[model samples]
Target chain A: MQGDPEVAVLRLGHRPGRDERITTHVGLTARALGADRVILAGDGANRAETVADITERFGGPFAVDTVESWRSILREWEGEIVHLTMYGLEVQNVEAEIREAHRERREPLLVVVGAEKIPFDVYEAADWNVGVTNQPHSEIASLAVFLDRLFEGRELDREFEDAEKVVVPQAVGKRVVEADDE
Target chain B: MQGDPEVAVLRLGHRPGRDERITTHVGLTARALGADRVILAGDGANRAETVADITERFGGPFAVDTVESWRSILREWEGEIVHLTMYGLEVQNVEAEIREAHRERREPLLVVVGAEKIPFDVYEAADWNVGVTNQPHSEIASLAVFLDRLFEGRELDREFEDAEKVVVPQAVGKRVVEADDE
Candidate 1:
């Protein structure tokens, strides 16, 4: 999402077909806002069929990789990470996966959306923890844009210098783009 | 476990120190009865650790290979094949990764666990389907063997066959092990 400024919307969810209603809704909204990728994770109802359906709708260049736990993800971490950890699409081994991700140490634009408030560990890991992606969808949708705003904003790291960087180590080597409300 | 002359006792749930227990118990029970391998699964704490500690009891004679999922088990499928499709493990991507396994229609030894008991379906593609693993410590130990015996010799399949099999196809492949009372 950082590579371009035009992406207006993004919706993360579990599976594709079963979650197609939400994906379609997100796709329409993203097109309205001019967003980038419609990211997905977790096993939705009718997973194989659903993913196949969603893959057809993404009309641009993107990478789809099969990851075994988030540990491998951190080892392969690059710049500006984003986690759909608890994006309303529950899956097996999530707590274990997130624990692995925390061990990996990557700092990107983290925006997680779930039904209820996320557990404490995720919020500490996320740059912006926006609870309930579906209920008050419109309001949280605006929060995604706020991330774009901060990315475009100057001296984004000024907040980091103010607070102790206890979250992650400098060895991770990535600049964090955080928002005001976050 | 009751009908058959041999038995395989599985110590479910997590505890890094299970090997000592497995060694002591397996020798005390299964060894005395002259049973086969006392199969042990879980990350010691319900897939919590990198490997099940029980795999390393003896040095040369008892080397254990702990596979994260059944897909990791490379078996030449011949005879009455058993394909256990539990509703809660992390192996949900099997339709794609091991698509070939499902391609050729053949009977197999399928051991389906979890699903019916778990509160959700998003994680059903997993091998263990052990959502209860996350419950309180007292809640985690498996209840299958005793439940089988309690029911009196009729395996779960005779009763739950068409019901569960309809939701997950893998159940259709096995001659589900029965209990004793039936």
Candidate 2:
């Protein structure tokens, strides 16, 4: 998987717990996305304290690192579909980098997994924007199915393009409404 | 309004960019709560750039400040009832401070806002707890009505003591089934 790459799952967070959630969730997403590789990009780690937890959950050919190191990895991999998931409250620069990476490597679709509203600048940067459209309590699986479709040559049509894209300052409840409406 | 201590409104934030929605929705509530002070907390001024977007729609008297400055103002004000509305997303120490303040100051009630899950530890720290008992997108006014009756001695039988709380992650379009059910 390392000699040539196909997917980079970017989970942006400086915090450890969130990084862990993103790493675990992303690794799970990789198998379904059917990319050549799955990488966890965040500030998380696998320590002795979390080893039991990790083995039980995040099964990985995993490379976990900060966004900078992942950037280095993506450059090395050259052309792969990168799935970007933003964690935590601050996402100003991370989205820019995703858009920039998309511009540089147009081979892969940039599927953004957003926790909250993406900033306005990020939205303008996007080629296509859509909500995950996963039903409530079914996020993990919803994303999994989406990734699977990507592997099967999914174009991310209106179902996805119409997804309620939440940018900054929108209430979480409102996002729930938009997601349901679409 | 701050000088009068009877201004009947308060606007507080855990951080910036987070106060506007809560403040905007809490106006009818203040009247219903018979509140004379609206205390906005946190570094909301520096962190929240969208405050103006929501505040323009606001029609209430509220004081907002960074956490550093709000303390002095809080010490000077006294109320028969104190409704503490705060954002609870990764809080670890809310219980001790809120309880100590309540015990030392004889303030009867503290209303915690912005959490789908009520912090039991924090509630244990205060005299009583209040929360929304409706579906998602329920008006902040409804909650205010409940609190008003709760504080003005009109609805002493109304209770937040045994309220069932729902906890949900902030990811939008993610399954948020449990946040509204009580």
Best-fitting candidate, scored by DockQ: 2
TM-score of 1: 0.24
Residue-level lDDT tens digits of model 2 in A64-178: 3334344444344434333322221112223344444444544554343433333343443343333222111112232343343333223111111222331111111121233
Report the C-alpha lDDT of model 1 over A145-164, residue by residue, as the tens digit: 33322332221121211221
Model 2 chain A lDDT-worst window of ten: A166-175
Weakest 10 consecutive residues of candidate 2 chain B by summed lDDT: B85-94
Question: Distance from true position, residue B79, model 2, in Å?
Answer: 58
**lDDT per residue (tens digit) for residues B29-139 in model 2:** 333233333344444334223332222232223232334554444344454323332221111123334434434554533343432333334333323232221111122
Please list, in the order the candidates appear, how each scores on TM-score for chain B only.
Answer: 0.25, 0.38
**Tens-digit lDDT string for candidate 1 (B100-168):** 332243222122222122223212322222211111111111122112222222322221111211112
Which CAPRI tier for candidate 1? incorrect
lDDT of 2 at A78: 39
Model 2 TM-score (2 dp): 0.28
Candidate 1 wrongly placed segments (more than 4 Å):
A1-20, A23-39, A45-58, A63-76, A80-110, A130-182, B1-182
Best candidate, TM-score-wise?
2
Q: Which ten residues in a row have the lowest lDDT in candidate 1 chain B?
A: B132-141
Q: Please give the fraction of native interface contacts (Cα pairs under 8 Å between A and B) kept by each candidate.
A: 0.00, 0.00
